[model samples]
Target: MTHQEPPRGRRIPGIALRHRWISSVMVAVAQLIGTNGAARNQSGRVHLDALAYVLLLAGPALLPLRHRLPVLVAAGTTTVAAVYLALGYPYGPVFLSVIVAFFTAIGAGHRRAVLIIAGTVYTVEQLLVGHWLYRWLPPAGDGPTSWMTTSGIAAWLLAVLAGAELFRSRSERVARERRERAEAESRRAGEERLRIARELHDVLAHSISVINVQAGVALALMDEHPEQARTALTTIKAASKEALGEVRQVLSTLRAPGDAPRSPAPGLDRLPELAEQAAGAGLKVDLSTVGARFPLPPGADLAAFRIIQEALTNIVRHSASRTARVRLGYGPEGVELSVDDDGPSSPRAEPAVSGGNGLVGMRERAAALGGTVEAGPRPDGGFRVLAKLPTGAAGTVAVATEEEGR
Candidate 1:
């Protein structure tokens, strides 16, 4: 939902100065000509003169200030209109100014004031002027106004009030809808930012960890064993190439929103590649699965792959043990993955295992799909990471993409 911005002004722009001034002048002209025309036909009523013209113009002249001072303008217009009626002048378009003022006041959120002013005017016109003072008033021999006329005037006032209230309510509703839409857009932007951050962290952290380890090996062996150093170089090339590809895929979403990914996200199908990379880093990864394999949603598939990848990367960089174990279990409800290294954890790995973006990113990925990740030191040795992710139906998970701002 959307709303047009109201014109900016010192006061409520619903009754802008230009519009009020123009309307007031137009009303004054209309009342002058209309009252004269009506007076010609109703010969018994008091004829239009200088005093009557002043009163007719006076009510409309105050309309320009209604927004800034709603209660004062409403009361002033009502009082002037009541006085015009009491003096026995022929009634014509003089009521127009009163209508404009009352409507403006109510629309400006001064309904109570307008109501009180209108009610008082109605009472005075019906009781004092129409009934009691009609005899002494200018129209000689004029009798008290009939109850039917008073009832009609009362009904007219009520109708004006009702119409003004409706317009005010509709304006408020439009403003509210605009606010909700803005908040939704802001929330979407925030989610998109977090998704990009999380994806970048997972992608770079794992591949860089592999690259860092291989580079160290290549440097250590370059002089003593060129062949082994060359093999390490090859592993480094492969790891860097894979990392660049994944980074490109994740960033591609920013360029094209709501479009299918250039390549499918890696799933358990890439476990062999992960194991091979671990081997090059001198950490053997053992992969095993339980339960029948079934198709998983894209969000859950991507999350599981990243989790296992991060776990293996941590084992290669932080664990003293040479072997790491990865287990995947599929059930009717969800998918569970576990990565563990058996040995004492390296001193440098303590802070990472205890508190780092790797574990945080893994948990974020899993939680986005209503899953969970738990990582801690093993009882007798190294560290372990376990994640449980739900395999939801297609389109069920509303994962935020890198192109969220779009």
Candidate 2:
């Protein structure tokens, strides 16, 4: 069997000592009553006098084990008291031990057993002892109950209440600490995930943007200048290397503690690179605008950058055609980004199907910035992604266009 340690507050040596001292006082009082200021028992039994004192002193030693063995302590006290009574000793200290035992039982969370044992002890003690006192004296005339009787009942009630309060306070403290730890862990996890997402966005946006630009140049030279086409390919290689370096920097930052500052995070300002990279990747990303450019929210720039990055990535991964279009329009209110591809010439072309995390990530990103994203295949044989972020201003004008200026 496994033994669980009690809580720290409950484990203090002082608390056990406190219980022991209280038990010792009770036992001493009982011994004093039994001895009645004399060295011999009522029957002049000197051995009984010595025995009672020894047993009373021993009672305190059992206090340390009160919580661990409440029932046993109660039973032992009852047995010893029975012996003391049979030997014609006074009932004072034995009464106190019984009261203390009742409390120990309650403190141990064995209230049901305490009730049963208390009832049985009260019945046996009263029957064997109470009747004798009653027989010797008629009903009391104007006397507050005996000191032992009144105090024992009051002490038992107070101990049970005190024990319950101690248990409640301990429970609340533990629950509060557990909740704090859980919240701290959750916050840490959220920060780590955000950091990773930012790094991946940076790597992907930089690489794809370079590829789009090179592909555009290559297409421009395809028929008239084969050598120029090769040059554009070389440019693509350089861009890819630069992207790899940036990605490595990001990964390094994630793994190690460093003071090296990172380049500016990707945002709306990097749209040109994104469009150029998509063009290099064989997608003609046409970007145009309407309305005056105004300062966007802190997250707007990054949101714009991500929408375009994912759109271009989708183009590269899904479309078979050599042409795609991208548009970004700044309205009086918010900005809108839309990317569309012409219907693929081959029906066998597979569309990009994110295992779901990508879309969820995108949606989460957009929603966090008070924006929305919609993506689906166009009936006319293409795919489109549109994102709208409300600038929370009235000046924003949204626009949408595709094939036939649709």
Candidate 3:
């Protein structure tokens, strides 16, 4: 059998729920003891009276309402205790209920000024009533005015106030921590969702662009050039298959309860495949490396590859460019990547759709790794994109040597 926790605001069986009954029983016991002693008086036995019994039990009986009406309950209980003491009744644990109510008031978020007022009123009432009671029926010894009695009373009151304040502060701190943790979790979830969206956009956009171009080519040559159309169809099949695999990989990461073997993300090693895809789409891509190559951090590597892919995809879709060049340069500080296309500049040369997110995604990826990207129409003609990424100490000796040479 599974036991589910009750929702918030539902009452649970615990100390708080039983506090009233427990307090009532304690007050009854104290009253019984004090009354028994009063009855043993040799001068005259103090008889039990209905009004005295009612006043003595009033404070304890009201303990259960402390949580709902803390300040009011505290004031009520304190008044009852003061009146009971003033009536020349035997003093006992009547003040226990007041202390509990004070704690409830503090926990309920009563202000410092209100607490001060309550404390002052309660102290003054107790002092006035105790003095009158002492004069009316002097104790057998030093009485409540004795140093020990005064010090003990002061210490008990201070202890109750200090304990209540400490608990209030602690509860507030715990609530603040819980809220902070929830906000942090919310931010992490948002970032994860954005990462997934970026991955899907990159995968789908590039593959679909390639397939779209290949499908167009196949349709254009279906009758006149059957062999080339078949090749175009093959390219479409390959691009779609690759896109499906990448999409599945992204989805698998989100799946719970399964430990599927994870695939390493694409990086610079996939540049040749990207070039081949561009070539199949009728764009000649020439890739070159400079200053040697070094291993990059996983995130940096993926970001670099995606930036290059998005740049090339844009060229295929928007620029009327038939040829493009990709250059990779490594240095101790970071890796630099640039893509230049020899596309014709025309009013219709830009992407079919306005305000595409390709550049935004590229910039976001690079900026996340302390890198930057620049893209604009070339001074002479066509368009160009350049990106610089920071690699830190993880960069290999090739990068260091290249930097030294520079």
Candidate 4:
């Protein structure tokens, strides 16, 4: 789906200048033969006939320049032939130059001019050869068969013209479609980069800010509450480390040349770790699972993880609730993840310090996976976050608890 420009001065394979040269030589020979025979019959002398044939052959050399200056070449050759006709000379192969010119005009996207010139030249040639001049100096034929012969020549010329028009139209349409497709792809890539940038800013910024606050709290309490300070320091270290990993993962997408690429991204299997981390940050995160244990797509996993992480962070910072629940359920059609906190449920504007990037990032992620997400307060005095993602197949598996008859 990519186009590479060819090197300068390199000719395309089928359209080489050599083919034009060969065609010009062949057409010249054909003109020589046609004129030689016709002039001999018309003038009844060998010397004068040879001169006419030479003049006709001279016209065909113009064909080699048709690709560069099609209209000029056609006009010049046709002018020469028109003069020859006035002198009562024979029909010549130089007429082929008009066909070559029409072909070039069509290919070069000048169809209107090509049609006008083709119609004028063809009409003039028909009038001169078919009726007017034929009555005065007709070819050696006794029947209507001569008329058929002349008509056939005109039809063949028109057919070549039609073929050239078809080729040019199709080529132009294909080129237009290719350009449109490339533009669409460019727009999609730009949108994707913007989405990635927003996610990195939302996720890493929020995590690092939390880590910084915890570190500051630990420092402030070190001399007073040793045990509490130790816990705060531990949470600070863990948050900072996780922030570094998230930042590195985001930055890894922009790895420079010569850097070894990282492993494939995480998926749903890491959701439990995310819940555990939220619990460590002084939130009681209860985890639950339902249905199958089938593998989830990488995109689905990352989206689910980010959704849970944001929901927990919101609960930690905004709600007075100490307990949050994370739920995962796989079913016959799709997978679903939901987080709920039985905390202060009164609706309020999102914290000014963090903005609303978390909600935007979550919506963007879900949309990319062809999934759905909803975040709102429940009727039962709690906040809720829910997401549903389609799975390729339905599956079944055993579910286990941390201490099941151990």
> Against the true structure, whose TM-score is highest?
3
Q: How close is candidate 3 to the true structure, as a TM-score?
A: 0.82
Ranked candidates, highest TM-score first = 3, 1, 4, 2
TM-score winner between candidates 2 and 4: 4
lDDT of 4 by residue, 1-406 (tens): 9999888647786677789889988888877776566555654322445556656766777888888887777677766665555445554454665666666778887777776766676666566555665444433441222567668866877797798898888878997898888899899878868766865765675576466556666887889998888988787777778777766776776675246536445566766666666666557888898865666666677777777787787786677787999898877556888999997832432454443777777888888788888988899888999988875543222223212424
The digit string of per-residue lDDT tens for model 2 on 1-406 reads 9998777545577777786777667666655665564433333332445776766655555655666788887766655665565454554445556556656666566667766665665555545445444433323321233558745754664575466547746766887898899899899878767857765764665476556657777988989998989988887887788677767766766677465636655677777776666666656767776655665765677777777777777666556766767777776557888888875634433444555545666677788777899988888878888898877653342222222244
TM-score of 4: 0.70
Tens-place lDDT per residue, model 1, 264-332, is 888878889888988988889888988667667777888888899888888877788889999988765
Go through the candidates in order and give each one's C-alpha lDDT.
Answer: 0.83, 0.65, 0.79, 0.70
lDDT of 3 by residue, 162-272 (tens): 888888899899989988998998998888888888999999989998998999899999999999999999999999999999999888878842665278889999999
Off by over 4 Å in 4: 1-97, 107-113, 133-145, 226-234, 254-261, 345-355, 396-406
